[model samples]
Target: MVISGPRGTKDMLPESSCRWHYVEQMVRDLCRLYAYQEIRTPIFEHTELFLRGIGETTDVVSKEMYTFTDKGKRSITLRPENTASVVRSFLENKLYAEPQPVKLYYMGPMFRYDRPQAGRLRQFHQFGIEAIGAAGPTIDAEIILLATDFFQKLGLNELTLLINSVGCPQCRPIYRDKLQAFLHDKLDGLCEDCQSRFERNPMRILDCKNENCQTLSHGAPHMTECLCDECQGQFLGLQTLLQAAGITFTLDPRLVRGLDYYTKTAFEIQYPPLGAQSAICGGGRYDGLVEECGGQPTPGIGFAIGLERVLLALEKQQLLPDFKTGIDVYIAPIGDKGKTLAFQLLHQLRRSGLSCDMDMMNRSIKAQLKRANKYPARYVIIIGDEEVDQEKVMVKNMDSGEQCMLALQDVQSMIAGEMDN
Candidate 1:
């Protein structure tokens, strides 16, 4: 009998893992430069956390959650996203007692039971950052700028930033009622999901990907129109901050994100190369989330970039890194006695932080040379009893086709100097 990994999961071989490391390293470095510390939360949490924090009306809680009952009779779930968990941790740990606006970043797998599609899986990784306890519109603008900087660092220049403000608690209710009234008459013409969403979360219907829903939402109520004085002031302040920071963005009134905690500013970054699934990063200001998780009323803003989607975008645009660091040197032995010496040298070179490989299957000298040629090594070492007895090794320059005998102790220094050049 044989068993395979569950569908929608991928095995990351070395070639692909190299690319993953490149992206992860970039994320870590950028976050560090921006003074954002790393935060990690449990993979699973009480089901109520998501339901209350993410909102029962949102698709993430309504349909996508992977929930199960543990032996203790508690409803536990593998988190579909990180914001709620982070907020929960913040409240539980009382990080609010620290600095005014705590900056944190996280990277890990998030589970969801959605239909598998290109760059969409039941299990996927996300690189996200959260800035908590800052109510200033500049915080929102800075988060947006940070996201842009991250994409720019990865050489993704064709991405577009679309931003909007969904108003706050004081104004959203008025807009929701107006949107519901408009959609109520057109309910019969909408998709089943949109129809259901219209009653529960009318703002989400504006974000539906269904062509008919998109058309039906035309001329529908815009959140900008119903924003109260305070919300309007906040939106203008956000625009001012973005302008002051020299970050260009387009105001999109219809761009409502599909989450419950979001209030005021919401934004998405789209990479044109990925076709329909072009959004590479998305996030918004969930100023009420901290209070929703039982903490003091704290304002927070964040964004999450889908690692798989970013890789796909990079692949489409031919922006993937070289990914082939290759071996530093390949060792070839000419005889049985030479083979034993080659093994010893291989171990020593590896311990010295040099990537070295030897022919373990006893291939002929010619075959070994051919295999070594396949690698991107700078030098090839030929080991035999004559050179071993002489306390020297034959080092062949792979690119120049030049060979020289060098003392064993001097080989490391020679390679280091050549690499520096």
Candidate 2:
């Protein structure tokens, strides 16, 4: 039997790993600048956290969750997303008691049993930030600014920020009923998913990706048109705040998020160049999630960026930087005794905060040179029996093809000085 990784998963090989590191580091640095601390939640959590916080009606909770029964017959699930678990942690850990608002960011893998496509995967990674206990629209603007800055840092210029209001409990029901009546008449031409959602979550019908569903639901009632006075005020405040911050955005009345917990001020940042996978980041104000997750009546706003999709978008625009984890120096051993000295040199080079590698498979001198050239080593050292006896080594510049004899004690300073130059 042939064994392989499960489908809808990727290995993230060497070339891509460099890009991953660049993106992750940029996110971390920017989060720090924005005064957002890092928070890590478990990879798996009780199945109910998502079921309650993400809403049982949404696709994530209804179908995509990867759930299983443990030995104790308790239902456990690989986290589909981090928001629910983070909220659970905030409540269980009593983070609410300490601060007025908690600004936190996280980057990690999330598992879902969805169809594999250009950007969609069964197991994917996300970089997200959640601002909790903040009801002001300024927090919403700040979150959007963080996302825009991240994309700008990656050189993704051709992107759009779409904003909307899904309305709160006071008005969502009115829109739901109005939408249900409007969709009911058109149910004969609608897809099965839309038909099911028509009653449970009529707002989601506008968000459906199915071409047929989209076409049939064109005349459906918009959420923005039905928002209550308070939700409308909040939406207007969000737009004003965004404008004040010089963040350009479009009012997309059709942008209802696919989560039940979201209320008022929903948005998605899309890479218009990438067709179906254009949406690299999406989220909204889940003002009710905290209360739903057994916390205080604290409102929250956040967004999540799909790491795989972000990379794909970067590739489409040719904006991805080259990733090279090249070596700083390569050491070649001429013979067995010299090999012992080479090992010692390798250890010392590593301790000196320089990346160094040596031929470990006993390859021929020519083979070792070939391997050294493949890496981005600045200098190559040849340690033979004669050099060991003289307490010196022959250093060759990999790029200039220049050679110089230097004492063993000068190796560290030599490399450091070259680095400075």
Candidate 3:
């Protein structure tokens, strides 16, 4: 029986994988420049970690998680997001004992049982970073700058930075009460999800995507309106820091990121060209999460970029730079002797830092040349009985249509020189 891949999964073929590699390299380089080290955590974790860290009121925990029970009777869940897992690692590994603030970046697949859309998938990839143990607004502004710098480097210039101050624990309760009071009369008209969130997490009701819920929430109390002294100061400080860095942003009071852990400095980077699901990256400060995850009280902030959505935006805007995955040389061997020589030269050239390939199918000279062209080799080396015996090979520059005979030992140097030019 033939079986296909699961729904909401995509195979990245050769042509498209080049673009993914380019993006991954860019993310790595940016992380290096920012002094953020890479961190990898398990793809699955104890289901309780997410249930508590992400808050059971959130959609990811309530409706979207890939949860199951293992043979050991322990609840296991494929991670829908990494921040919770990262925090769990921090607590379990005693990373908090070493540094004042640890900065880490991660790139991997995340699973969710959501309905698939243009860029949203059941199993999607994310590139994200977390800076734990720092409470200052400078770190917050810097994280935003890091995200903006990455997109700018990729030529995603049309992105909009929407920033907001989701009141911290000190202030959110006040706003929650006010919001609940405002929505008390409108409960019957609200969606089932919003109705449940109304009593549990009224702030999340404002984040509902339902049009009717949105309309009902239009005049509801905003988090900024209730920011206490500390939260207010941090909010203003974040704005000042970002402006001092010459980064412009719009204040989006309605931007309550779909996470329970976020506190203050919520922001999203949106690309208008991608339509409704335009947020390619979103994150904020979570000063209380470390303590929530069984660690000492530590301040933290982070953001995650949806790779699939970012690629879609890059494609829509024609921003991807040229990525060539072609080999530097293709060796077409005509006979057994020539094949032996080609194999030796292939390894030698590779050791010399050149990408080279040889035909193993034993095709005719004409067929070998055709395969070389299809391989899109920059240079083709013709090895035959006569050339093998003469200790010379004919090298043809596919681009310039220039051909010349070169000593076997000189071929590597010739290609190296041409590459340098």
Top lDDT hit = 3
- Tens digits of per-residue lDDT, candidate 2, 1-421, equal 9889999999988888988998999999999999999999999999988899888867898899999999999999999999998899999999998786899999999999998888989999999999999998889889999999999998988789999998898998898888888877788888888777777767778878889888888877788889898898888998898888888999888887777888898999998777787898998899989999887789999999999989988888898877676798899999998898899999998999989999898988788888899986888899988998998998888889998989988998998898898
Model 3, residue pairs in steric clash: none
What TM-score, over all chains together, does every model reach? Answer: 0.93, 0.94, 0.93
Assess the local accuracy of residue 375 in candidate 2 as a C-alpha lDDT between 0 and 100: 89
Residue pairs whose backbone atoms clash in candidate 2: none
What RMSD does each model have against the real structure? 2.0, 2.0, 2.1
RMSD of 1: 2.0
Candidate 2 wrongly placed segments (more than 4 Å): 207-220
RMSD of 2: 2.0
Q: What Cα-based lDDT does every candidate model obtain?
A: 0.89, 0.89, 0.91
